[model samples]
Target: MEERKQLKKTLKPHWVWAIAFGSAVGWGAFVLPGDWMAAAGPLGVILGFSIGALLMIVIAVSYGQLIQKLPVSGGEFAYAYFGFGRYHASFCGWFLTLGYMCIVALNASALALLIKFVLPGVAMQGLMYNIAGWDVYGGEVLVACIALITFAYLNIRGTSISGFMQFIFCLTLIAGLSLLVIAMILHPSSSFSNVQPLFNPEIGAVSAVIAIIAISPWAYVGFDNIPQAAEEFNFSPKKAFKLIVIALLCAAATYSLTIIATAVAMPWQSLIAQETVWGTGLVVENAYGTIGVILLSISLAMGIFTGLNGFYVATSRLLFAMGRAEILPRVFAKLHPKYETPFVGIIFTCLITLSAPFFGRQALLWVVDMSAIGVTIAYFYCCAVAYRLFSWTSTADTDVIVSPAKKAMTLLGLISSTGFFLLLVVPGSPGFLGTPSWIALFIWIAIGFVFFMMKRKDFARIPKEKLDYNIFGKTLESESISSNTTKKEA
Candidate 1:
């Protein structure tokens, strides 16, 4: 019992907001708006994000119910543990880990990409080896290395410090976004005539929405970070559930407004035609000139850092939970006694993230796309867990049953996740990952399969002790409250 209290429960409500909302806002917020404009015109992008937000609401509701029932550190992994036994839970955890790790890598690569765009020649000047047709520069790799190490260290220190950093950055990001939107509206340089052909004729509205849905996981990745740190929250389960919903709405606002701001900053035609891929910065510069671009760059850096920090926290917690459960290695569960942070897991994740920048941004994006598929699989499993628990009398020593309202939301979440997976993988589908991404996905899955098979013996004979952490024992408390309320009414 004393050792169980080792992890500090110090995260406040705002910290929860910072981690979840910050993680959800990522490099996609800065870079993907142009792609959104291209795939779906201004009208199409708006509709795409709107539908995407609805889908996220369903998933968030499902997650909220699950987290209230069992507020633990593993997030999706914990949901799977309660639904299916260790074997399947291990698979789910590993799959989700791949997704989080990819996001970490994606942020690292994005840092380099952002720097290169902001300060030209600084990133590309120091030429290094090339891989897969992308040039790997020493300057770029150096920036990524610094980011990876810095965030890992921050997380290693503790969630409180990391959350503090996240809060500052998130505050700055929101402020900057508001200012950008206002600037775009005031600046007459941007012509409303630029937003012609509301819906993209090439893809049509249906496919455009599907593309947005396909990339939805990356766009809104941070909301689940709240649940990933469920054990660290110094709040009630009900409050945690409510906060998760808030995080999702905040993320939706950030992405939607970002898209609108991009369109309003510059004509879509001129924005897309620039030789450089960074349409966001160019649009901002065009709106308010060089000073505006610099501010936008600063805001972008903070946004990227927030994402990097949030994912670092998430990946570490996930690996720590998996390690404690003996899914990967027990070493990953090791926490610094002084800091109570999962140092080993943090280091391991940092090392893995450092490798991605060498492949450059495009390759890193391939990882992000593949991660979307992985995360979607985990989402499906989580919804399945909700369904199983909703109909069952008991699970993982808990007597909680999902209410009908929550059950309906779970069903919707399941359906939405399934649709997303199909869109992502189906041939001739608008949202299909390209050949390179597919190859990467296959390799990652094969590795995970090999690990699972190797651990089958350990998984089969999993000791009773490890199972204890998986059962959160919240059902009894819930039952007590319900009984008290009933008695008072009588």
Candidate 2:
């Protein structure tokens, strides 16, 4: 059989960066922190944002180093394969893909929620009618399902088109955020007092720090997304790293300002009592009236759509990478003959995402929190790999340099991410209440290990030397020899 043609490496640097930003910005800015704040209080939100952003930078930088060293489509899986082994890599890839799918579903559900704000009367009336004995939210679920299907179809139609759509959505989101900033600045109630220090001396600084780190996990949620685009990035790890940083900065600024604006415009007591996810929208409405609410709802909906599309892209690529390594069914590796996209995997992901809305909003949040746990586990592993690559290795590879600053950052990041994961697993915490996220991860990894042993012979065919680093720097002769040997042996 003829070898399958590789995907076209056509995404520009800007789009690559936008994907990372879009993935991080989604419903997270509007929804996630409020939930955390409600649970912990304003003190928690303040501490969480500060510490979370700091920890996120460490993980992003480590990933930057890892992607520079090994720019492959597998993200955490690719790093684990080289640093640990095929089995470990497969486990990371599978979990990461699963997490992305959950994010996609979460985004879809958020979009549905936003729709109610935009058309409350219609939504409420639909709920009263109780089509199929459900409610308007059920109708919203149907709408979100349709939206996911439409995007999946669009993605299969072509990568360039999908990328362009994502670009437009991202630009619209940024423009909407800019408008929000202007509105908040012009609001009669706006003041710097909204940004008061969250932790007082009486709060016990050390305990406050721990609480902040625990809450901040929401802010660092999307950093793993960059590595998933390795193939589309032409293997340029440095460029990818810059994109991740830029995205994180944009997200942090938006989050900090949003929190401050909300606190300033609305009383802390009222904000804390908000049980609805639409609290952000309510704040915008109060600040600027109907137009402000419309803009906020539209921006949030766009953010969710763009985020879902980005996650679809990343998750499909991750599955494709696993399939290429024979850890998953070969069908997942198949590219559309004309579009050169992973059509099957994308379709499957959309189906899963569409089905997820039935779980209700809180249940959906629990799923996302669980997925976040998986991502944190992946980040911890990536930090370890970064430390190993930088400290223990003597190779002349620029990507592996162990700068004292980077080392310190990586160590801190490792500690923060690991501790955050433990916090998530605590009873009464988001990940602990419903399904134990850690337990789910363990079961998922075990399944991957079983599959790895079943296909150990196929994995052995690809030599350790060839798989050690990304396909970027090797000489032409070395590439040819490895390619020929693998083909002949297979």
Candidate 3:
């Protein structure tokens, strides 16, 4: 008989922290602040993000508890299975995969966008066809593909290399951005007078903060990535919550600080009016010329790299977990003999992202917009699962009863997650998805249902016991719960 394969527990707390923090603050920090500033002025943007980050902390509490309880690779997939059944697990896995894969692709294209900002017209060479009004170019495609390949290879090599790289990149990103922000603050031209309006006139103070809050799902996505890598953590699961909370605080500060840095540098109103390709870069350039651009470029590159690397780890691990549970093809679960990495899933993510550059950034944005819905759904699942699993107990033993406070918090997370989902899908809402994104979303849901039908019998016959073993490494049990519910509760 062959030995059952397992993922190595090589992830230290720092690497895990890197995966959480580095993933949450991606290329959006450097590139999108100007758009955010335009919609909401510096104070509005900062306050909105600060509020959003706090809400995310509430949602993350459920996730932290689950990581402590489950400690599995599939994240919400495993949680959904334990709480509901295989059907919900399949649903959770399908949508979460969309969110992760789209971000992986989105990050690659962000790299191309970064390059174009650094060297104007360089990515415009060898004009390819245009999609959704954004032209594709051979130069941009080559750059994105090269990045996809390099990161895929690194992931296939092993988590240690990728995790270490992410840690180093995150540190360098912090250092570079710190220097750039400090330079912007100290430059002779910078002035408090430049920030004339603390809030945008068009969006209104209240409305502007609301707008920033609506996009919170996208801005803080990389942190939930912790649950996906929980199976690899070398430390006690007890420590996962601490790392997640710390990472969340860091990410919140980074998003808020980046905007402040840009707003303080120059007159953001004029920068937005000019509509430069990259307003943040332009701000730094106006402050210190070539030297400022170089500093910003290095920072932006590191930000992009961490996003790319972090999502690659996330997407691959989710796919690997699903495959091991027979939710995907068995091949996706297979590991590289030498490196013991999920090479198949890693390669699959790379191949999927490689095709994204061809569609142009405009087209890709539609998918990303749709994907926020997918991630919100996953958040809902995690909180719901946590609530059901921890709220009530089956045993008569007083010690086994979960605290009322913890139970209430999970319910709050569930409700907030549901709100996040509604903000995206509810028509007439400020954060509602466009027609294209809605169409893509329905099509994706339809496909998930169809795939479920094809595997319906297999899912039924496999037995939940076997699934627990396959996905969780053993049949998980808690002394307080017998069948996730007690006769008294039922």
Best candidate (score: lDDT): 3
lDDT of 1 by residue, 43-131 (tens): 78777777787788788877877777777788888777666656667888887899999988888888888888877588887888777
TM-score, one value per model: 0.92, 0.84, 0.95
Candidate 2 least-lDDT 10 residues: 469-478
Which window of ten consecutive residues has the lowest lDDT sum in model 3?
481-490
Tens-digit per-residue lDDT, 112-201, candidate 3: 998777775777789989899888889888889999999999999999999999999989988988887777888888887777799998
lDDT winner between candidates 1 and 2? 1
Local distance difference test, each candidate? 0.78, 0.69, 0.85
RMSD of 1: 5.4
Error of 2 at 458 (Å): 6.9
Clashing pairs in 1: 24-222
Predicted model with the maximum TM-score: 3
- Total clashing residue pairs per candidate? 1, 1, 2
Candidate 2 deviant stretches above 4 angstroms: 1-5, 40-44, 122-136, 189-209, 215-218, 392-405, 426-490
